[model samples]
Target: MKIVIFGGTGFVGLNLAEVLLARGHEVTLHDRSPLPPAAQRSLADYRERLKVVQGDITDAQGIDALMAQGCDAIVLGAAVTAGDDLERASPARVLEINVMAQIPILLAAIRHGVRRVINLSSASAYGAAGQRHRILDEETPCDPVSFYAISKFTSERSVARHAELFGGDFLSVRLSAVFGPWERPGSVRDTPSLQFQILAAFARGEPALLPAPGIKDWTYAPDVAEAVALLIEAERPRDRLYNISSGVAWSALQWGEAFAALHPGLECRLVSPGEKTVIKLHGGDRAPLSVRRMADEFGWRARRRAPCSGRS
Candidate 1:
């Protein structure tokens, strides 16, 4: 299989590229930014299977030109993720990157007769609906609240519409709270998981004063990449939309306690929901996503986890 990822140089994209390459698929990473030195080194073993190219998904002409090279499938991994200051920032860019960007890419996929396409949608599309429902599934109605969530939902609709018009096979997978290796604070996203903050705090010898210890399902990035790879390789997808998550809602206290047990020295402190902290977090109720669909269709489930990494 020959696969091309639009935002392939980013954290999740890079991981997906590696996973696909491991599965014996040729991968091309198309991104505006150059591949990092660490990534280049990390994937050196599969260098022949991987091609790192430079292109911006927002540029329609560039996308057309790149799609000309041809690929077995395309994965739209390009999006500007929301950060801590999401409400007050990049309102236009959020819509532009997440919503508008998919138009040209899907059209080109149709033009080139690409076999399959996967849009890496976000679980945030559940939005406030999570507060209402216990578990989010493909059947759940999207109640997008944040700008990022709205864009993702809009893009999913756009992809489905394009697939219908072009007679294409496309799948949109809503990813959960993913955090793991090759993760970093970047221009696009910050480390949002309580597990990550606890690990980093312990490493820095700082108090893990996490904001709002509410329940949320956290998926490891590696597991996410693998699930996506399988979806990309699916000969006949059972559904157009699926949720890739841990499938279990874990409270902050539960995760923090696990972290403490792993590293007994550092304490996990939880600030009250209304209180202020270095990083603002929500202590609100959460809806865990069901992975039953993915499991039932592809025999897929996340085996790895959002593990605490600080060790002696």
Candidate 2:
């Protein structure tokens, strides 16, 4: 399969590109920024299977030229993925990148005779209303708390509407708390994984500390990438939105313990439960993502056997 991933240089995109390559799919990474040095070295082994197109996704002509290359599928992974930061920062830019920018891309996919197009939406689509449900399924109502959430939800709707109009094959997958390889720290996204922080500390020759521990669905990046690959290759999807997650709620301390055990010398310390932490677990609600539909429909499940990756 020839798959094109927009924002392919980003964390999730990079890992997805690798997973796709591993699965014998031809992967193309389209991004404005070139691959960072670390990603370049990490993906060096798969150079033959992967291709990078450095261009502006917001430009219509650029997108047309990209789609002209002919692809089996296209993954829209480009977006500003922060809730509070987007709310505080440029909210309009959030819609511009996440919502408005997707229209042309979707159209281009339709025009290119692409078989399938996957929009990488987020669990943020669940928003603050996600707090009410202990488990969020694809059917949950999205109460968008921030523009970022609104943009993701709106993009999903826009894609659905486009499919309705053009009869194009398109799907959106909602990913939750993804932490793993190729993920880097930047102004675009602020929430680093507990596993990521610990790993970074180990790299810096310091102990990893979990300030405040809580429970949330922390999905590994490679696993999530595999799930996306599964959907991209699916001939027909029963649902428009699917959750790609570990389908488990793990606490910071629990992760800290296992993480430390995995890396013998890496020490991880967890602070008191009441202290501030990376993921703010609201009232200790383990709002795990419901992957039953994905399993039942696609036979896709996240199998985590290695240490989760992330950046600081």
Candidate 3:
């Protein structure tokens, strides 16, 4: 199969691309940014199966053209993972990319007769509901407070509605806090992963300062990629909305400590009351997302082999 991932240069996009390529599928990564050097090196072995294109996600014409080139499936991975700072600085741009830009791509996919469309949503879409509930499922009512959350929820509904109206094989998967390879600070993604920050701090010979345990149902990027691949390849998924998550909660401090043991100069510590750290948590830790739907339907589950155990 031939697949194209919007925002393919981003963290999860790159992971998904590698997974698809490994499965013997041709992939095109269309994004506003060029492929990072590290990702380029990692994917060098699959050069024959992968193509990277630099273009704006909002360009309807470009989307149509890409699909016209014989795309079997399309993954909507472009998004502005905004926080309070970015929301305040550029709210419209956030909506433009995360919500409004999705319609054009979906329309193009439909027109080109793409077999499947997978929308990569976020667990942040749960927003306040995530805080209120200990477990979030597809049926949970969402009360998104942040612009990023609002946009994600809106995008999910938009994709679902499009599928309903056009009878297209389109679905949305709400992903939990994703952290793994190819994750780096970028213009659109202001919130860097705790793991990234910890490794970075150690590299600078400074302790990884944390405001709290930074606990949540963090999912690995590779697992997420595999689950999404399942969705795209599934003959017909039973539900329009699903949650892709680790199904267990863990702390950043635990992960940091495990890493510190391997590195001589590394340190991970809690911040003192008056001390400030550049590391920013995405939001107050929320409850874990339930992966029952994903697991039951596709027989997929997150790999919990990371040292970050399910300890308070």
Candidate 4:
């Protein structure tokens, strides 16, 4: 299969690209940024099957031209994950990138007769509903509170509406907090995963201090890549929307301790009662997402981090 991934230079994109490439699929990575040097090195073994194109996702003609070249499937992963400050400063840009930019790509897919389209969504779309429900599924009602959340939820709807009107095989997967290989600081996203922050602390020889336990069902990126690959290759998925996650909740501090175990001299612990913390957490603890649908549909479940379990 031939696949094109927009936002392909980003964290999730790179992971998905690697998965597709390893599985012997031809892949084209289209993004505004050039491929990172580290990722380039990691993917060197599959260089013959991988192609990287630099372009703006908002450019409709550019996308159409690429699709014209031929594409079997496309993954829409371009998004501006905004925080409070970015949302206040550039609200329109966030919506434009995260929401509006997807239309032309979907249209191009339809125009080129692409077989499948997957929009990479986020658990942030759950918003306040995440805290209210003990286990979120596709049917959970959302009350997105932030601009990023609203845009993601809106994007999912846009993809579904396009599919319905055009009779296209397009679906969106809402991924939980994803962290793993190929994660790096980038321009579009405001929040890096807690695992990334903890690793950064380890690199600096500083203790990882927690703002809070920061518990949630944080899925590994590689696992996420595999789940998405299943969707991209499946003959026909029954559902229009699905949630992809580890299916178990764990705290950031626990992850930090797990990392500390690997690093001899490092420390991972919570802050003093009133001490200040530099580490930024997305929000308070939320429930883990249920992966029963994914398991039932594709026999797919995220790899576990440890023995602890809940909500799988």
What's the number of clashes in each of the models?
Answer: 0, 1, 0, 0
Stretches of model 3 off by over 4 angstroms after superposition: 305-312
lDDT of each: 0.81, 0.81, 0.88, 0.88
Per-residue lDDT over 1-312 for candidate 1, one digit per residue giving the tens place of the 0 to 100 score: 989998899878988987898889999999888999989898999988889889777889988888898888999998888754754667888889998989988999999989999999988888899889988999999898878888899989999998888889998999987767667656766546666666677778866776666567878788899899888887898789989998876666566767777666877778766755564453356688999999998888887543444321
Checking candidate 2 for backbone clashes, the offending pairs are 180-309
Better of 2 and 4 by TM-score: 4
Q: Which stretches of candidate 1 lie over 4 Å from their true place?
A: 272-276, 305-312
Better of 2 and 3 by lDDT: 3
**Considering summed lDDT, which 10 consecutive residues are worst modelled in model 3?**
303-312
11-105: candidate 2 lDDT, tens digit per residue: 89988988898889888999888988988887788888889889987998999988998999999999887646545778888889898999999
**lDDT string, candidate 4, 202-291, tens digits:** 788789898877887888888899999999999989998989999998887887887787668998888888777678997667788888
* Per-residue lDDT value at 121 in model 2: 95
What's the lDDT for candidate 3?
0.88
Local accuracy of candidate 3 as per-residue lDDT tens digits, 85-199: 8899999999999999999889888888999999999998898998799899999999998889999999999999999999889999998888888888778988887878877
The segments of candidate 4 whose C-alpha lies over 4 angstroms from its true place after superposition are 307-312
* TM-score rank order: 3, 4, 1, 2
State model 1's lDDT.
Answer: 0.81
